[model samples]
Target: MKYLVIGGAGFLGSHLINSLDGEITIVDDLSTVKYFEKKPGINFIRQKIENFETNEKYDYVIDLAARPSPEDYINHPVETALSNSIGTYKALEIARKSDAIFFYTSSSEIYGHAEIIPTPETYWGKVNPNGIRSCYDESKRFSEALIMSYLRQYGLDVRIQRPFNVYGPKLREDGSYGRVISRFIYQALKGEDITIFGDGNQTRAFLYVSDWVEATKKMLGKGLKGTILNIGSDKEMKIIELANTILSMTKSESKIKFLPPREDDPPRRAADISKAKKILNWEPKVNIEEGLKITIEWFKGVLN
Candidate 1:
């Protein structure tokens, strides 16, 4: 099948492209990632998705383009907002015109400091509209609304997936924008102090990228039109525990250091994947330990 993957050079997008086997075209601005080796069956276009104009039709259009990390969003809020809002609109329009199945990769941050623990898709979410994170969070919420509107007005076949903290190979392992797992692994590999932004009490459910790709492929194959599902592992752990796990796995002398928390950082995040289980017959197979081992190996290679 032919596919259009916007932001296909980013962490999750790159993994998705690598996992797919058909004709695929990747449109990206290369904001976060600059260089990707060209491979057969994948066409790479180095352009912003908002400006991407294509009359060619595809069977699937996957929108994964956005500044997803909290630090990254706060730094480039305008770009983040535009990519999710305008870029999303452009992607949805492409899907509508092509009569293709559209898939949007939303975020767990949409459920900001959710009152519900393992947040379900039904939760309306408690988000600060004017907060630092609102750019990323609100944009995602707005994008979902846009998708639903198209589905209602134009009968567009669209699917939305809210992925919780996903980590594995190709995850940005640099600066403040890096994800928790990758950052911890990077510090441990470098024998530097592993920094925890809060009191190390915040919890997050981490899903390996491979498992996320598997579930995404299943959802695409199922053609679950107009469905919103959470794609994440149900296993939850504290930030301190995750740090300790990384230190143990890497056998590093890195100590855990707690710092002041960032603004609007959620205290806990877990996904209620019951909907995905019942609807797509999918569940994350790699546990935290196994996932970490693989990630640690990749980080080691990068560091060396």
Candidate 2:
């Protein structure tokens, strides 16, 4: 099927683009983007989704476009919200018009600090609307609503996956956008101090890129009509424990230091992925350690 990947130039998007077979179109602007290089063979469109006017459409549209980093959003909240809300709406509109399958990438950030350990899709989030990171969390919440509305009103084929802590190759060093996994991996490889934000008790389930993509692609082809399934590993770890695991694995000389946690930092997060597994029949294959080894080598090449 013909596919269009929004924001296909960056890290996660690039990997997703690479994994696709058959004809694919990429919509992105490489302006001020400092991570992955512009890939080959992708039909790259150089325009912001806001100003973007495409005569083309697709059989499937995967919306991976968003300013994902909390730090980036803090500085540019307006653009952050706009990118997510408007960009997702446009993608949904295209899907509705084309009668295409639409997959929307939401986040575990939508779960915020969960009142529960492993957050089920039904668990209402604990996000602060007034918090500094609200730009992303709330914007994605708005995006979810918008996409679901299309699914209800127009019966546009739609599925939403909320990925947790996805990390792999082509990571950007811009600090805000990359996950804790990429940040720690890069710092350890660079012989730099590993900074753990806060006292390090905050937890997240880290899903390797391959595992994430595998789960995602499977769910995108299923009976989950207008459903929100989280695509992530069920493995859980604290910030400090995760840091130590990396240090132990790499045998690096980098010191693990502490910083005060940022606002809206979740106390703990994990996916109660029973839905994705039972429904989609997909589970994460790569364990954390194996995933880290692969990621570390990728960073070594780029940093060297």
Candidate 3:
């Protein structure tokens, strides 16, 4: 198998590359990665998506490259938006020409404020167009539009997976861009206070990296053909409860610090996985407790 990962050096791409049974090829700018390390079967080239020109054909093209950090968007909005939009356009072009299976990693952020609990695939999301995080969220939403357009017009095989709060190894925790998992876990390990951007009641489902990668593979293989799926765990946890869980799991002395609610953060986030389960026969096997153990181990190695 021949596979091409656009952001192959980043968190999700690195893990996915490790699991794929293929001659893996990677194109990425490892400038932002402070803790990135190379792994096996990966032919990596330090390159950006805009200048990434390759004649090599691939059987699969998985695009995990994008500026997914809120800090990036705030500091360098232009560059962030470019990486999200133009970068995706180039990768989809490659997938189209090669007739390869295209897998795009979308986010659960698109579902801004759910109209119902456990949002199904058919539910139209409620997003603020002019919000602060719109650069990241809207760019991803536009990327999805591009993929669907290609699939519809050119008959390309494209798979979309919207994963929620994925956390594990290779996370960027230099206080740059990441969800609560990496930063909170690091602080909890060090006995620092955990900061919540919104009220402590905002709920989210954190999927382990392993589950996310497996679901991506499955979706690439069998869930395409114009099927958009939400890949997330249904186990919801409050922001405060999540902090407490990390504190308990790591045996840390970190205290929860509440702050004013941030703009556009939904009160609760939970996915309706009936479509994913019925279609791909995929469900999260690892619970949060087990996932945290694995994640804490990784964080310990990083901190040490």
Q: Tens digits of per-residue lDDT for model 2 on 1-304?
A: 7898887776678787767886788788764356655656667787777667665768888888877766777878888888888888888877887888999899899988788878889987888997898988999999999998998899988999998888777666546655588788877877789988889888888888888878777866756678789888777898888888888887889998888788878888888999988988888888888888898888788788
Candidate 1 C-alpha lDDT tens digits along 87-123 = 9999999999999999999999999999988999999
For model 2, what is the error of residue 80's alpha carbon versus the real structure, in angstroms, after optimal superposition? 1.0
Model 3 poorest ten-residue lDDT run: 31-40
Clashes (N, CA, C under 3 Å) per candidate: 0, 0, 0
Q: Worst lDDT window (10 residues) for model 1?
A: 33-42
Q: Extract clashing residue pairs from model 2.
A: none
Ranking by TM-score: 1, 2, 3
Give each model's whole-structure lDDT: 0.90, 0.81, 0.83
Model 2 CA RMSD to the hidden true structure, in angstroms: 1.6
> Can you give the TM-score per candidate against the true fold?
0.98, 0.95, 0.95
Extract clashing residue pairs from model 1: none
Off by over 4 Å in 2: 35-40
Candidates ranked by lDDT: 1, 3, 2
Model 3 misplaced stretches (Cα beyond 4 Å): none
